[model samples]
Target chain A: MIHWPVPEPEIPAGTHPALAAVARAAVAAFRDARGRFDRTQLAEKVDMGADGTPTTRLDQLVDTAVAETVDAHRVNLISEEIGVIDNGSAVTLVVDPVDGTSNAVAGVPFSAFAGVVAVDGEAVESLTTWLDTGRSWHAKAGETLPYRTTGRRELDGAAVSLLRPHPKSEDAWLRVSRRAGRVRVLSSSCLEAALVAEGSLDAFADPGSDTHRIMDIAAAAVLLPAAGGALIDAYGRPVEIDPDLSRRWSGIAAATPDLAEELAEEINRPSS
Target chain B: MIHWPVPEPEIPAGTHPALAAVARAAVAAFRDARGRFDRTQLAEKVDMGADGTPTTRLDQLVDTAVAETVDAHRVNLISEEIGVIDNGSAVTLVVDPVDGTSNAVAGVPFSAFAGVVAVDGEAVESLTTWLDTGRSWHAKAGETLPYRTTGRRELDGAAVSLLRPHPKSEDAWLRVSRRAGRVRVLSSSCLEAALVAEGSLDAFADPGSDTHRIMDIAAAAVLLPAAGGALIDAYGRPVEIDPDLSRRWSGIAAATPDLAEELAEEINRPSS
Candidate 1:
């Protein structure tokens, strides 16, 4: 069993009530699940998710709690496992209940609770909580973040985080890894994007894999720009709020617009 | 500054008193350093280490604290920064004061304090503490660890952690990554080794990158064997406690001897 306890996220005062509730629910549910189940049980595939992928037991447990919290708050939720819950309300919560389910279930302590508040199909604010340490990053559209990025305009000599290499994107992954001064595969996209926002990392990308769903990049869309960074797709597609969970993109988040653009161009270069 | 607090390590009972003191000293020094220095200041290169590499201020501060603790306990010391502290005693503490200094300085929270108690040039016990969370693992040689390994015999479907891809070792890195069921580059060797001991990961390897010094893999030398696992050098060299800091090894720690051998063989394969 993972004997480590999950701490409460350091959410700021003015966060949306619904977002705060969902974050709390996720933290509590995750803590309870870790306390009860061992690694194998927590990671066992329980059912299919809304994203057309297998869901781990830990994901299901946390999603159940998040669902109940969203219901009680009378808000709609577009999430990884639960798919869509439209209550005919203007306010919607886009969430990745467990951003790194594998890490969480394996007792690696690098998963996160990421959510964005969208109104009229437009994201207005976001929050990401590192479940292991309760460190959080919160931001709203059009407003400057309390923290800032490194303002790096190029990928050379920059510290970057990336997804695990897929066969399809192996060459693209290697290209980025070769150019960057330091490379990491933390396996938690949300937490990685938060690091980029806080100036800890210069950038984070999916290379050319196109593996990210809306829920995976939604909070980052709202967080990055406000933190003096830019968010785009590796293939020049827009990262927007969508109820459809099947659509995927290779999200590229970086410290500056130039860096994001340069990453997209580099990742799209022909594989050697 | 990294706004997170470093908690006290939960060192198990019956650990060597000198080892525990060094752990405490390292923790306190790390907390103090993080509290005072910003990321840039903390990560700044302070001096060249005894290992013939640049040392960060964070490493230097923590190493100084550990050195003092070793002196107070009247034991010799072999570490990254301060090199060999020959008190002329039979007891020596082999330590990596900050195993993941880059991660720690950048607020990634994946760094560790790893140490081993060596008597007459043989490691007898080990302790590894996650400096961010204070969670620790302690084990003695020739005694079974209460928490055992996964006992995985093959790398076909094993969960593996690796160091980041280096230029000369990229092909070898991909070979291991492609064959594994799950791949991670957490960039913290000591913490990754601890994960293997706790069964959270099946194995961790350097993938033909001869980047590991004695302090980097010393604790795992004692921990893995006691946890029903094996530790081997990727090039078939013996991993022993040596005072020569310039020497390097590609360390492979696995859940079983068979897995360790398979990893070494795979890593040594010719590049594709």
Candidate 2:
């Protein structure tokens, strides 16, 4: 019975009208599907996604809603189930219709609908809506940001969220967990990054798995930077946001660039 | 915008009236504190808990409210902050006023207020109220259960939640994560166990840590078993629910006894 403040969408004023329209449409579509998200229906495998993950019925439905909505705009669409849709526009909208599909299917209440708008391979705007709660975080490339990170410099007693490690990265996961005071695996990249942006978490790391696509991290890429944090690849390089749906990378989003670099070193350091 | 069915407390008619009163008081106290749970106040270390962890301001406040309310009843109390309150009554109430204190402080929205009533060293009634949302799950030893687990028997493709491994148990964590189809570290033991009872998760494991006390797992012990699932120690033995705040045990709650036993073996298996 903890009464949390009801969060409202914080849309930046400088956002493109078309982008705002598309984001609103995506949210509406997700809201519709969320109302009917049944456990049995959610577990039904519909098809294989472009990323080689199996698509559940809920995934296919939400993807279609977001795809059709974004297709109305004069921008290219990069998504998971449908891959790349060439709209012949300068802007590319990277959309993860539903991030953390497993949590949504299982009613864990931590999934989100995320979309990021980029121009010429550079992200300009981003929006993420928590599907369970209507709260949202939106950011524009150069506008004054609404949130900021904690700027905690030390790893001791730091709280971090990590992706469950792939077998090859098990040792690295152990190393990082041993260094930090607390480790969490929330299974939603976008939401975890959002938590970092809002200073609820110190960092979110995906050690060595190339499981993250542009659609998954693009929104976070905009959010973390705008909030004075940084998201980078495992080698401590800035992540590129291209419209290529097949590409994958390992990355970490931290409250500060220094922390991001430190985490990269810890994650990439050879195990003793 | 997901239309979750409003969760009402499923209190069995056989539940002790005083126990129910204490549970309600705990929920009220939590709700009051949750209204103003700012990060700064939440992180203020006020005192050392009886369990040896540092207590936050929020923890002390909520613990005080619950303890005061429970003390009004004719029963002994065993809690995290205060070791034991001997009321000269045979029935003892074990309570974790706020489980997942870190998550609560960080606004992770996955914490819970958990309690169990033990009569003559036997857990007879349990209750867990999700702190963020008002959803609650309650169970009595002999009454019909409110929810049931998925009964998913296989380890592969099953969604399981584990506590982020302590450094000493890193290998066991790797083994358990590799065996499951998906792994999550929600960091809230009671709420995670509630998820298992409600079928959102297949299992929840604590590996080999002595972090879990009776207050944390006592509610789950009753709810899981009544829901046709089982919670057992790391060695696959039934977890004894004595009202001892000082004792600790590692445990797992799964949809079936077979799944629990399987997880125990996987965690205890010799490393290659």
Candidate 3:
């Protein structure tokens, strides 16, 4: 409903049209591959990762094809399957060849997304696409990005849904439903987190939320922050991009930093 | 996804093709009107009701137009604005001209729908639809109904989209993100709730829920239950159909009974 005007900014002057074309082609290829496969077919194509996460042959195939096309762009890459591959450049292209693996595997139309975050070392600019539905959103230094937040957007009291319903899932839903917003549940943490960034949602929390591998949050790291959002780990640390996603971090709480901190305190607070 | 098979039952011997055609035409006309008018335009067209609920001239116009066409069918009418006008018949027809009035007036695409639930005044059957996007879902006694649920065939722990975000709006997003298969705020409580029965969503809940009248759930009453789903009041009571939809109910929770109850309990429990 908020038709905020979008502002454009100048980018590094270079012909990245080829990269863009390759990106489009990769997206088309992925969608085509998926269009041919259903949930049962997807399950057959997936394998368990070393991190106990599910990875599909399609995931690997798509990532490889995209990497092959974008490799010549000379941008350093940080991907989900393969770790960081440096191209001797200061700018890193953080990519998630696919975000909603489970939805894809389940044949849910909500799946299919590819994200690109241009990172200048610590600084990042995020671009995300909901490939299945083709809803694209991005935010860089120059544009007044698609996702922005209004802090202090509190619970008006309603039901809630959580990814890894905490030990206090029951209590959490109850507390929020009464005062904040009501809870509901959905899969695809990345998409949900993006909703939080877009101000369409108030928060996204997960306990035992080890599902997010490097590829998932790589895009989110750039997207959330640029959109006035923050992400926190379960132990209450700032959820950073684990370049070597071989190890699992605690969990995630993505929203405004203040609210994220408050929620962390509330969830971790001693039960009265 | 639980494929609740609901093979089409026998359409009564004298089901009129003309009647069905007229209903479909009315639905198309209403959709066109709503499409051309954005949210601001819709707000101007509506008249506020005494119970703090708002009604639109379009709503009445659509209802009357549909009813007038179906008048010769010798069926009792239970509708939104006009309540019930009994010509004294064993069979009843429930109609909702527009379900998501708020979203319709807000320029959100989460509105637009027409449904019919025909019953013998006892058990219900036949849930036919023309939904927000002009897509239709028809369910009868014997048909392979498409829907999904975790474990049991219900809307529990499923992606939930609510019209009003509980606790704070953020928590609604969080709850759906964490618990349900996915989280969506589609804006139309009626369509969203109907999707629960159709298995498009795990469930639909509205604690601060309103904007639904009898006609809203009439078609759903037949389809959801026929598809093995249920829609209940806040107190977990069956929604009664008055000959006239003079009084508005509190809100609706449509899902598998188990999922609906679990969510409702969590939502209504006293917060510490």
Best-fitting candidate, scored by DockQ:
1
Per-residue C-alpha lDDT of model 3 across residues A89-159, encoded as one tens digit per residue: 76666667667665554433344354554556553555555554445555554445533654433434312
Q: Which candidate is the best by lDDT?
A: 1
DockQ metric for all predictions: 0.78, 0.66, 0.15
In model 2, which runs have C-alpha deviations exceeding 4 angstroms? A1-40, B1-37, B73-75, B88-91, B236-238
lDDT of each: 0.92, 0.78, 0.52
Winner on TM-score (2 vs 3): 2
Question: Which of 1 and 3 is the better model by lDDT?
Answer: 1
Error of 1 at A31 (Å): 1.8
How does chain B of model 3 score on TM-score? 0.72
If candidate 3 were superposed on the true structure by all CA atoms, what would the RMSD be?
Answer: 8.9
Query: Model 2's CAPRI class?
Result: medium
Chain B TM-score of every predicted model:
0.99, 0.91, 0.72
Task: Supply candidate 2's per-residue lDDT for B119.
Answer: 88
Best first by lDDT, ranked: 1, 2, 3
Cα miss at A180, model 3 (Å)?
A: 1.5
What is residue B238's positional error in candidate 3, in angstroms?
7.2
Candidate order by decreasing TM-score: 1, 2, 3
B132-169 per-residue lDDT for model 3 (tens digits): 33444455544435553222334334656655453343
